[model samples]
Structure formats: structure tokens, C-alpha cells
Target chain A: GESVGLHLPTLSVQEGDNSIINCAYSNSASDYFIWYKQESGKGPQFIIDIRSNMDKRQGQRVTVLLNKTVKHLSLQIAATQPGDSAVYFCAGRPNSGGYQKVTFGTGTKLQVIP
Target chain B: DAGITQSPRYKITETGRQVTLMCHQTWSHSYMFWYRQDLGHGLRLIYYSAAADITDKGEVPDGYVVSRSKTENFPLTLESATRSQTSVYFCASSSLAGGLHEQFFGPGTRLTVL
Candidate 1:
């Protein structure tokens, strides 16, 4: 079965430092990848997304890097803050039926320490 | 003001009971999706709709049914709620396109089956 997986289930980051979360996908045809943030008891929020054509995309303080060759994806957060503490998930979407249907990976919990 | 929302932030039900989770989006996107989040599994798509009156099953669709009679609403019903069905449910929506499209999620509904 084609699925997405993460390298770390939990990550502890210090305030003002940087954080990186990694994900590996099994579907080689996945053309789109995204990173999401979910706070306790809340929904997964869209952080950033990177297309297979591009290697990286940047948002406010987050960046998503996609490596189609290796079927890997990563999320990088700059100057981590306590508010940035949440569960991060990487999702992959394939071009199917004129709509890109996405599948999610097991989440990586991010804990920021002040 | 424009975002996704889920009803009944928390639900408590018994096994064999019927439960319906609601997801509403203000963006009026063309695609709406239902997903479940558990402890280790990040999120598994239960169903998705490309438009009103057109829905398709996702990775995990058993024991669940969805309907999209309107563009802004997508509801998921668990015919017979079970202990295994006790998980956080999320609603997401996206525009019609293949790559570079990101899914925005709603606050999840935590369902507990006893």
C-alpha cells in the first residue's frame, strides 16, 4: 500500500532555535506535498506546501522541502516559538481524476521549550 | 471569517449508536474531505467530494458515509459507532487543481465511544 511515514514521532526544540521534521512517502507518483500544524484539540492547519516541480516553498516562518527523487519531504521552522508547538504532519497528493487526492502521514509532535 | 468549522467539538456515544460529524467551510471550495486522526496514525481520509452530489471513498471508508448536497457542507456519519471509531475527525477543503493546492482543515471533533 502507498503510504506516508515520518522519521520522528516527537521532536523537542528550544525557543529561538530551528526545527526540522522529516517524512518519507512510498508513492512515486505523488506530485504534491504539504505540511500541516495541529494544536492540541484543534484541526491540522496548513503551514506550507511544495510542488514536485519545485524543491522548496517558504511561508511566514516555515518552509517545505520536497525531494521527489528520494520520495522524501521535510518541514523547517525558523526561530521556533512556544506557539509553534504542535503536531506536524506531511501529506502527499497524487494527480488523480482531475483532482489531487491527498493522503497524510503519521504526525510528528513538536514541543518547544522556552 | 472565511475558514472551516466542525460541529460538536466533543462527542460521547456508546457502541452501536449512530453519530454524524459535520464539516462546514466558508471558502466554498470545490473539494471537501473527511479524515480521522488517531494516536499513531496522522490522518486517514475517510471520504471526499469533488462537488455537490459527487463523493468518493478514501483510504478508510468502511462504516462511514458522507454526503455533499451543497458546496459548503460535507457531513460524515458513522452508522454504528464502535470503540475503534473513537478518534478525532477533521474536515478539509481545497480548490480544484492538481499541484500547489493546499488543504485547509477545520477544528477536529473528538468522538469517544464507550
Candidate 2:
């Protein structure tokens, strides 16, 4: 019954501004978290990921922050661009005994306004 | 042609009809997964294969079947399709050597059951 969920369904932001997407997960055994970006008519692409051992991880122009205490995760994007408009999903992988599987959240639609 | 690929990008079928979605990956990854993406349900895992002839059920595996006869291919078959089964299906692959958290996804197959 554990799940990963987003705090917002849609977010609108102006160009050149920073954007943040938030997610909450209920699986306490989750050891890895990942963020994915899916453009219209395309498959989800890997963005960034963080391990439970670390609280923050940085990528090209994005950063993933994890709060294990609250079971919250966030993806931060700098200087939002039109190309950045898409749906973003957060996923968690539990360190269970069997094969490793990931649970995905509903996703948040990011709209960049030029 | 080097990455993951899916066949019959779009399909339409009537209820009770049987349909199969084909997926292939050039990376020869050890892990393959099938997931369905719906309006309010992000991506739900349907089935996964850890290796050739090795398969397991995922969160939403009912009404679906999967097989990994070879390392490069993993197909999903719906024995009897229903209107509620209509959704966009994505196939993903991850190498055991490259870490299981990062998966490469194919475009997707859009299935519509009438």
C-alpha cells in the first residue's frame, strides 16, 4: 500500500525563473530515489537520482534533494526554459530482499511560459 | 536503432481481443520492465524480467503476461483486452553491470481497447 505522490498536479513558471517539483514517498525502506522527465509523445527520460545515504545530488542544471525524515523529495531546475515544459515523475526503490523494483508517482506537469 | 524500440507504436482493438506489444533493446541489458501510464496513475509496473526465462509479476500484473525468451527482447501480451486496459505502455531496460536504478526506455505503445 506504499506509494509515491506529488504535491501538485501542475506548475506554471516564467522563463528564466527557477522551478521546483515536490514528491512524498511512504516506503521507509526505500534506498534510492529518481526523477524522470517525459515530453509530449515521448517516453520518460532519466533526469537525476539520489541514494538514501546522501541528502542532495547535483546534475547539469538540476538538483535532487531528499529528506528521509519526512520522506520527501524535490527536484530543482534552474532557469526554466520552454523545452523544459513536460511531466515530471518521482520514483522510489526499496531495498527489499527480492528483485529490485521502483514505484512511480503520478507526476506533475511543468509548464514554462515564455 | 541502437537504443530500445517498440513496435506498432499505436494500436486499436476491441474488447476480448488479444494483443501483444513488442519491445527490443540493443544494450542487451539484464533487466527488462513493462509499465503502463494512465491519466492519474503515472507509471504502474506490470511485469519484469531479470534474465532470459526469468520473469516476475509487478504491482499491476493481472490480465497481463510476459516472457523473455532472449536477452534483447521482452514482450507483453494481453490475453483478453478490456476497455479499462487501454493505456500507453512503456518498455525499459537496465544493465545489471550499469546499476539497476538507471533504466533506458523506449518511446511507447499506445493501445486503445474499444
Candidate 3:
């Protein structure tokens, strides 16, 4: 069975420091990958995404790197803040049909220390 | 402007009871998804709809049923709730515009089956 997995179950970082979370996926057929941030009581929010065609993509305060060769994916947060403390998830979607059906990884809890 | 919303942000029910989680999106993005979040298992897709009246099962849809009578609404019903079904459920929507399939998620519904 194809699965997406996170290396760490929890991560701790200091405020103003950079945080890096890693993920590994099993299915090579997966073409789309996504990163999500979930608060304690809210649903998962989209952070960043990268297609297999691209190795990296950057957004405001966030960057997503994909290494298809090693089947690895990572999300980096710059200047980690208290508000950035939450659970982060990585997801993958294979190039199946037209619709987007994604499989999510376990998750990594990011905690920012003040 | 309500982008996406879920009814009864929290719910509690007994085993064998039937429960329904409501999801509505104003974006009308043409794709809607339902996912469940558990402790160790990050987010598992339960069902999705491509358009009105079009529905399909996702990774974990055995105990759940879904319907897409309208484009804005996609409801998930648990035929007979079990203790294992207690988790947070999220609804997401995405569009294929610009060849991008990034998803936008709703707040989520927390269900506890006692």
C-alpha cells in the first residue's frame, strides 16, 4: 500500500528561528504534493504545494521542497512564531483520473518556543 | 464572506446511533472532499464529489455515506456510529483553474461517539 509518512511526530523551534519538517511518500506515481497546517480546533489549512514536475516552490514565509529521486518532501517555515505552532501534514495525490484524491501523512506537531 | 463552513462544529453521540456532518462551500469549486483526522493518522479521505450528483468513495469510506445533491453541499453520514469513529472531520474544495488543484479547507466538525 502506498503511504505518506512524516519523519518526526513533533518538532520544537524557537521564535525567529527557521523550522524544517520532513515527509516521505511511497508512491512514485504521485504527481501532486501538499502541505497543510492545522490548529487545535480548526481544520487543516493549505500551506504550500509542489507538483512532481517542479523540485521546489516558495510562498510567504514558507517553502516546499520535493525530491522525487528519494521520494521525499519537506516544508520549511521561516521565523517561526507563536501563531505558527500547530500540526503540519503532508499529502500526496497520484495522477489518477481527473479529480484530485489525496493521501495524507501522519503529521508533525510544530511548537514554537517563545 | 463565508468561504467554507461545517455545521455543528462539535457533536456527541452513542454507539450505533446515526449521525451526519454537513459541509458547505461558497466557492463552488466543482470539487469537494471529506476527510477524517485521528490521533496518529493525520487525515484520511472518506469521500469526494466532483460536481452535483457525482460522488465517489475515498480511502476510508466503509462506514460512511455521502451525497451531493447540490453543488454547494456535501454531507457525510455515518450509518452506525462507533467509538472508533470519534474524530475531527474536515471538508475541502478545490478548482482546476490554471491547472492548479490546491484545496481550501473548512473549519471542521469534531465528533465524539460514546
- What does candidate 3's lDDT look like per residue over B1-114, in tens digits? 899999989999999999999999998788898988888886888888888998988878889999999999999999999999999999988874623236788899999999
> Which one wins on DockQ?
2
* Total clashing pairs for each candidate: 0, 0, 0
Q: Lowest-lDDT window of 10 residues in candidate 1 chain B?
A: B95-104
Superior by DockQ: candidate 2 or candidate 3? 2
* A65-92 per-residue lDDT for model 3 (tens digits): 9999999999999999999999998988
Evaluate residue A84 in candidate 3 and report its C-alpha lDDT on the 0 to 100 scale.
Answer: 98
lDDT, candidate 1, at A106: 84
RMSD of each: 2.3, 1.5, 1.9
Pairs clashing in candidate 2? none
Candidate 1 per-residue lDDT over residues A1-114, each given as its tens digit: 458999988999999999999999998888777788889888777778777899888889888888888899899999999999998988887756233356778899999999
Give model 2's TM-score for chain A to 2 decimal places: 0.95
For A2-114, candidate 2 gives per-residue lDDT tens digits of 58999999999999999999999998999988899999988999999999999999998899999999999999999999999999999888877233367789999999999
- Model 2, position B42, has a per-residue lDDT of 69
Model 3 segments beyond 4 Å from truth?
A97-101, B96-101
* TM-score, predicted candidate 3 vs. hidden true structure: 0.92
Candidate 2 residues lying further than 4 Å off, grouped into runs, are A97-101
Whole-model lDDT values for every prediction: 0.86, 0.91, 0.88
DockQ rank order: 2, 3, 1
Which candidate number has the best TM-score?
Answer: 2
